[model samples]
Target: MDVDPAASAKVVGNMPPNISVCILSHNYAHFLRQAVESCLAQEPGDYRLEEIVVLDDGSTDRTLEVCAEFGSRIRVIPLPHRGFAATLTESVRHCRGDWVAFLDADDWFAPAKLRTASGYLRTGAMLVQHWEHVVDGDGSPLLPDPHPGGNTSTIIVDRAAALKLLPVTNEKFFHVLDDLGLGARMTHPLTFYRVHGDNMTDRATPGAHQEYMADVCGEIAVRLADLRITPPPWASRSALRRLTWHYRAEARAHEVEAALQRGRRRSAWGPLLRELASTVLAGRNYRDRGPSIHSVLTGRPCVRLAPSPQEEP
Candidate 1:
C-alpha cells in the first residue's frame, strides 16, 4: 500500500507504538458523533494515537457534515459506494499508523480498548480482538453472547498484514487462519455494539454461521490437491458428536452426513447436494459418524495431546 511516508506518522527514538483508527460509515450519521468521540476519548496507555478518520462510503446522509462537526480533529474520506470489504481496502491505503483499528459507524470503542491493544502489539499476532457490549438504540444494555464474534469493530490489525490481504474480508478469514498468522482474543475491556433493529445478526437466517463454515470447508477442499494427512481421533466417529458443542456448523453437519453416506475418506469436498437433499428428507444427524471437515480438508490438527503413558514406550 505505498503508504505515502509523508502522510504517515514517523516514530522517533522514544515514541510509543502508534495506531490509526478507521470508522467505516454508510449513512449512519445519527450515530457517527459518539463513535468518533469514543475513539477520541481513548486512553493511549502504551501507544500513541496517530490519527482518526471516517471512511464514508457514499452516504446520502449528512456524514460529511458530521465529520465537519469535529473540525480538523477528524479526517473524512469520501469514496464511491463500494461494499464493506472494498471500503476496508481503501481504509488500509489511507492509514499511516503502525497498526490499524477498525470501528463500525454503529459501534464505538471502550476507553481502554487501544491501551489493551498496546499490550498485545508485541505479541506477534496479526490481529488482536476484544469483547463487545451489545446495546439497543437507546444505549441500554442487551444480553451479549458469552464470547465476542471477533467482529471488525473489535479488531486492531497489523497494517502490513492487512495490506497484503487486501479486500479485508473477515467472513472467510478466521476459517483460514492457518494461512495467516495468529489472532488474539482479549476477554475484557470491550467495545460497544448497537442493535438499532437492523443489526446483521437480527437479519441473518438461522444456521448462517455453520453454513458459512461448511462452505469455507468446501472451498478449501477444492483449492487443496495435496491435502494428504491422517485425521486424529476428534475427526473420528467417537468424537464427532461434539460438533454443536463447539459451534453450530449446519453446513459442516451436511459434509459429515455426506461423508457418512460415502462411508469413506474423500480427498476433497464436492457437491453432496443430492445426498444432502435426501438426508434432510430422511432426517439424519451428521454428528454420529462425521469426520472433522477442517482436519480432513485443511490437513491441520484440530487438537494436540501428549502421548499417554499406555501408548508411550
Candidate 2:
C-alpha cells in the first residue's frame, strides 16, 4: 500500500483528477464490499474521485443490496445479464470522467492506486497499468503477477482511447488481452487479483480457454496489421511465441486430466512427454523464468515471468 512519495509527486503535480471508477459485478456479492471500500478509500489529494459506478449484471444474489448499502455515495446501474465485453462497454458509456479505471468485483485496488495512476495519466499516456499481486481466495499472496498488463483491474485508460478500442459487440478482440493494444505498463504493484475457483477464467475448461486465447492472439495480430502499428515489447513475436507454448501446454494438460479421470494413469505419459519436449524448445523469455508448464498441465495456477521494465514516457 506504500507508494513512493517522489513518484507520486512527479505524476500528481497540481492538477485535480477528473476520474470515474467502474466496477463490474455478477454474483460476487460476497466480495463486493471489499472492492467498493477500496475505491472509497482512495486518497488522490486535489484529484477528484468524481464517481464510483457499479454495474450489476443481473445478479441473482445480494449484489444489489450491497450496492444499496453505499446509498448515494456511488452510482449503481442494474442491468440484465450481458457477458463481460457488453457490460464493460455499457459501463464505459455511463462514465463522464476524462479517465476510467475498472475494478472487477472479485479484485480490489491498493491504497493510493487511483492517486498514482491518475498522476501518470495526466502526463498524456493513453494507458497505464501497475503490477498486480495475485492472491488466493482467502487473500493469501500466491505470486507476483508475471503478466500484469491488460487485466481490467490493473489498468487506467484514457476515456477517448478506450471508447475507440473497446466495442460493445464483437468484443472478443478486446476481452482478455486488450491492454496489449492500449499503452504503457507501470512497474509498481497497485492491485490485488484474486484467483479462486469461481473466477470465470478459472471455470472455463482448459481446452476451451486455450482455444479462445489462441483466437484472441490471432485477432490481435490482425488488428496490429490493419493499424500498421508495431507490436509493443510485451506483445512482440517472442511474447506471442511464449503464449503459443502455453496454449499447447494447456491442451496437452487437458488430455492428461482426461486420462486420469478415466483411470488410465499410464496414458497420461504420452501427452506429458510431448509437453516436456515443447517446454524444452520454448527457450527462455526470462532468465531462469518461463511459463508454468507443470501448473497448466495440473490445473494449478500458472506462474508467468514478470514483464520487463520499460522507460517511462
Candidate 3:
C-alpha cells in the first residue's frame, strides 16, 4: 500500500477526538490508504475519535510505508499474520476509547460512518451497527445482505460486558459466518460490516475451507449449548432446528469435500443442501423459538425476543 505521503499525513492529522478506530490489514497497500482516509473523513462533531490503531499483519507490500507517513496520530502495530481472530483480539484489548470501531484492510468506511455510529452509541445500548455497501473488486455496489443498508456498522456496547460475551475477534478459528455468533447475542443494526470478494472467508482454500466451516458450526453448537444465556421458547426451537440442520450440513460437506478431491464436481445437491442448512440456522435470530424459513434466505431482520441469549451464538 504505497500511499502518497502528503495524503496520508492529512488523513492522520484530521482524526476526531473521542473514538478509536482500528484498522487491520495484510499486504493490501493499494486499499490501505483509502481505508484510512475514509476513517479520517469521519465527521467529527461532539463525538470525535480519540485514537486510531492500525495493525499490519505482516504486509510485504508498501503498506507499512503508508502507515509510517501518518506519524503519531495513528498507532502502528506490526506482527506476523496471526490470522484475523488473534489480530483483532489484540487490537481490541489494547483499545483505549469507550467506543471502538473496526475496518478491514480491503475495506474503507463512508465519510459519515463514525459520525452516525457515535450518534447511535449515545442511546446506551450494548451495540448499534448499521448496513454497509457490498462492493465488487472495482468497488462497485453489489448485493447487500441482512439489512438492505448492509451489516451493522455503529455498535456501542459496554466494552467490558461485550468482551465477557466472547465477542468475535478476527483471529478466532471461525470457518464461515463466524461473526454470526457475536451478532446473535446483540440486536441488529450494529457496525457496518462490509462484504467483498477478497474478504477472509472468501480467501479460504479449497480442501481446508469446508472443514473450517464445519468446525465453526460445531463449535457454535457446543458453545451455545453450554452458554448461560437462556433461549426463549422460539429461540429454543430454532436452536434445535439449527442443530438438526447442522448435522446434515456437516454430512453433506464431507461428501462435497470427498467429491472435490476426486475431481468430480458432481451434483449441486450437496453444496446446495449445505447452504440451505446454514440459511435455516441463520434465520433462528428472528423467531422466539425458531427462525422463519422466509427470513433465513431473505436476510430480513427478525424482531428479537425480549429475554433470550445475551452471549454471542
Candidate 4:
C-alpha cells in the first residue's frame, strides 16, 4: 500500500508538547484497536500529545495492521522479544515529549484522562497517576468507581526523571525495582485505571510469589542504599523465615510429586497441592525474591509479605 504523505506529515507536525503516549503490545490484536481509538478520542485540543509510540514486542498477531490503520498518527516500533522491561525502555528512549504516558495493547484510556492530568506537568514530580475504572473481560465497568492502582492508564511520568533513575527497561531488575521505589518516591494524583480480566495486572497465584518477592527485595535494597538506612533486624529475621519455609516447601513438593506419581484424580486439592509445592520450590534466599504475587495481582508492586503460608510436609 502506498503510504499517505499528508497523513504522515500531520502525524509528525501536531506533536503534543510535554507529553508522549507510548503503548507496549504483544499479541493483543482484539483490544489494540480500542486502545488506539481511546487515546485518539481524548478531548480534542485539550492536550498537545507530542507522539504516540507503540512498541510492538514481536507480536505475531494482526496488531501491526490495527496500528497501521491509525496512519502516521502512531509510530510502530518493532523489537525482538526482550520481555516487558526492555520494550518499555525502547519506547521511553524514542519519546520526544517531556512527559511520557503508557498504555498496554490490551488496555486503554478514559476520555478525560489526559485532560485531567495536564495540571501536573513539571520537572520535579517524577510521576502523576490517578484512579481507574475497573472493567470485565468484555470492557464493561466492573468497579463502581475509579480506584488508585498502577496500570499504564494510570501512569504519566516525567521522561527525563525516569531516564535519570533508570535508563534501560530491558533490565528486569531495573524496571521491577524502580517501579516500587519510584512510586514510593513520588506523589501521583492523575490518570484513570481500568481493571479487566485480560489486564496484565490481574494474573497472580500464591505459587508465583517468589518472582514477586525477588522484585520487591531488589527495589527495597536500592531504596535503602539510596536513603542510607541500615538493614533492620527484621530483614535478617525475614531471611531466616524464608529459608525455613523453603525446606518445608520442598518437602511438601516432594509429597505432592509422590501423590501425582500415584495417579490421583486431578481436582481442587490437586491444583492446591501443586501451587503450594511451586511456592516452596520457587522460594529463594530473601535476596533473590523479586516482584510479589500481590503486585502481580494488583496493578502495583506493594511490598507486604503476608504471613508466610503454613509449613507443610
Candidate 5:
C-alpha cells in the first residue's frame, strides 16, 4: 500500500473523502471477522470511514452473531438472498460514502488499503480496481504470485458514476463489468481474495469456472453492443450463440493453460498455439473502447462499475 509521495499534493483538505467499506457476505461467518477487522484497522486520515455496512443475504448460520459482535462498529443489513448483484445494489443504496470499497466476506484487505485507494481515486478515475493476494480458505497465501487483476473486494468506485449502469447491469453481468463505457482504471494490490471451496466460481471441476467466465463474457459482449459504441461484428443477429462459441473455444484453451499453472498438465503448447492463432487471426478492435477480443480470449483484466442497483441487476 505504498503511496507515491507525489499523490499527497492532490489531497484537498485535512478531511478524507467519504469512503464506505461494503462487506458482502452470506454464510461465511468464519472469515467475516477478518474481513471486518481489515476495514476497522484502516485510518482514512482525510474524510472518514462513513459506513462499514455488511449486506448479509440469507445466511442460515451464525452470521448475525458475528455482526452483533461488532457492537455498532458496523451496520448489518439482513437481506433475503436475492443474489450477489442484488446485495451489491443494496450496498450502493445503503451506503452514505461518496466512494464505495467492496469487500467479499471471504477476503480481507491490507492495513493501508483505504489509505492508498483514496489517493488514487482523486486522479478522476470513476472506477478503480486494485490487485488481490490469492489466499486459501484459512487466510494463508495460496500462491507465490499475486493476482494483478480485478476482484469484488478491490472495486472502489465513485457512487454517482456507478448509479448510471443500474438497469443494464443485472445478475448475469454484475461482476463481469469491465468496460461498460465508463472511465475505469487499475492500481496496485491491497485486497486478499480467498479461493475457498464454496466460492461462487467452481475451481476444482477443471473447465467449470472457465465455462462460466465464457458465458459471462458473451453476455457482456451483447450488452456492450447495446451501449453507445460502434458495436462489434459478433453483435449481429444470433450474437449470443455465435459469440459464445468463440468465448467457449477460447475458454477451453485457457482451462488447459490454467491446469499447467498448477503443474497438473504438461501440454501447454497446444493451447498456447491456438491462443496465438486466435490473436493473430481475429481482427482487433471488438468495438475499440476495449474489452478487446484478445483481452477476453486471453483472460485479461477488465473493470466492473455499476451506477445503480434498481437500475441494473
Candidate 6:
C-alpha cells in the first residue's frame, strides 16, 4: 500500500472513501503499531477504507516513530498533550469520509470490521457498532465478549452525526461513553478491547470515576433538555438518583478492595456493607426502568442491556 499523502489525497478526492478510520494515541507506543496495522488490513467490500489518521497526543514514548514507520499509508499528526477530548475533536477535522470509525490506541479492529459495519451504515443508520473481545495486556482473552455494543472501538458513526456531538468540552466524558451518546447499539463482534494496568479506566481512582459518571449524567441531562423530550417515569429523577447510588456503590467496592489489599479484613467490612446496601437500593430503583436518559436522547437502547458473554447466566 503506497501511502504517499499527496497521492492518497488525490485518491480520496477522486474515489470518495466510504469510511475514514481514525486512531488516537497518547503514550501507548507498544500498542500503536498493532492498532494501525489492524486498520490498514481491513478488507474492502460494500465500503472502501478511504483513509487512516493517526494522532499522537504528545507522547514521550516512541509512538511517533511507530507511526512514522507506516509512512504514507496513514496521516500521522503529532500534537501536544492537549488531552483525549481535544485530540478527538481535532482528529475529526482531518477525516474525509462519509462515515467515521474510531480505534483507541490500545485497541484493534477485526479484518472484516468495516465490511460488516458498512452494510448497516449504508442503510441510513446514524451509527453502527459491534461486540468486542476483551483481552489482557498480553492479548489473551479475558472475557471472550464482554461488551456486545459498548466499546467505542466497535463504533462507526456517520461523519455528520459525529460532528454534531463534537467539541465535547467535558474531557473526562468525551470518548468515554461515546457509543451510548451516539446511539450505536446495533452490534457484531468485530473489535478487540485490551485491558491493562495503564489503561485510563484502571488508573482512575474510585472517586475520580464517580466524578466522571456525575459529569456524564449531567451532560445527558443537558442533551435531553435540548431534545425537548421529557424522560419517561422510569428514566426521571429516581433513575438519576439510582445512577448516582451505583457510582457510590462502585466507590465503596473499590475501598473494600483497598482494605483487603492491606490485609485489613475487618476494616473492609464497613465498605463492603455499604456497597451491598447501595447495590440493593440501586437495583430496586432500576427494576422497572425503560431506556435511560442516554438511550432516550440518542434514540437507541442502552448497550448495558445487550447480551454478551459477561452477561450470560
Best by TM-score: 5
- What is the C-alpha lDDT profile of model 3 across 163-248, one tens digit per residue? 43354532221222223332212223223344444556632343444455456545545544444265422235455456545544
lDDT of 1 by residue, 1-313 (tens): 1122223243233456689999999888889999999999998597889999899999999889999989989888999988676777788889899888989898888888888777666555566777788676766666545336467788787776565444444433432231233455567646887767544341223333434456644444332211213222213322222321222233445454334333433522443333334334434454532445544454332323322222221
Evaluate residue 129 in candidate 6 and report its C-alpha lDDT on the 0 to 100 scale.
60
Which number leads on lDDT?
2
* lDDT string, candidate 6, 1-313, tens digits: 1122232222223333388898989999999999999998887776777789998889999998898898999998899899876887777777898877888899999898887665555433455666788777777787745566554577676676556445653332223223233233444578888877776652233234433444554564444333334442223545545554554565555555444434455665676567667667767434323223222334332322212323321
**Per-residue lDDT of 26 in model 3:** 81
TM-score of 2: 0.64
Clashes of each: 1, 1, 46, 20, 17, 4
- TM-scores for all candidates: the values are 0.64, 0.64, 0.58, 0.59, 0.67, 0.64
The alpha-carbon RMSD values of the candidates against the true structure, listed in the order shown, are: 13.9, 8.9, 12.6, 13.8, 9.8, 11.3
Deviation from native of the Cα of residue 58 in model 4, angstroms: 0.4
- Who is ahead in lDDT, 1 or 2? 2
> Candidate 1: what lDDT?
0.61
Better model by lDDT: candidate 2 vs candidate 5: 2
lDDT of 2 by residue, 1-313 (tens): 2233345433434566588999999999999999999999987564688799999889999999999999999999998998776788887788989788889999998988887766566544556667888777767777644435457788776676556544533233333233334345577778888877677663234344444444554454444343335444335655555544543544455555545444455666787666565555555332222233344355443422222122110
Clashes of 6: 4
Q: Model 3, which residues run further than 4 Å from truth?
A: 1-18, 143-158, 167-197, 203-214, 221-313
82-132: candidate 4 lDDT, tens digit per residue: 777677777778889887888877777767767766643421235655556
How many angstroms is residue 163 displaced in model 5 relative to the true structure, after the best TM-score fit?
Answer: 1.7
Q: Which stretches of candidate 2 lie over 4 Å from their true place?
A: 1-14, 144-149, 168-182, 219-313
Q: Give the C-alpha miss distance for residue 232 in model 4, angstroms.
A: 26
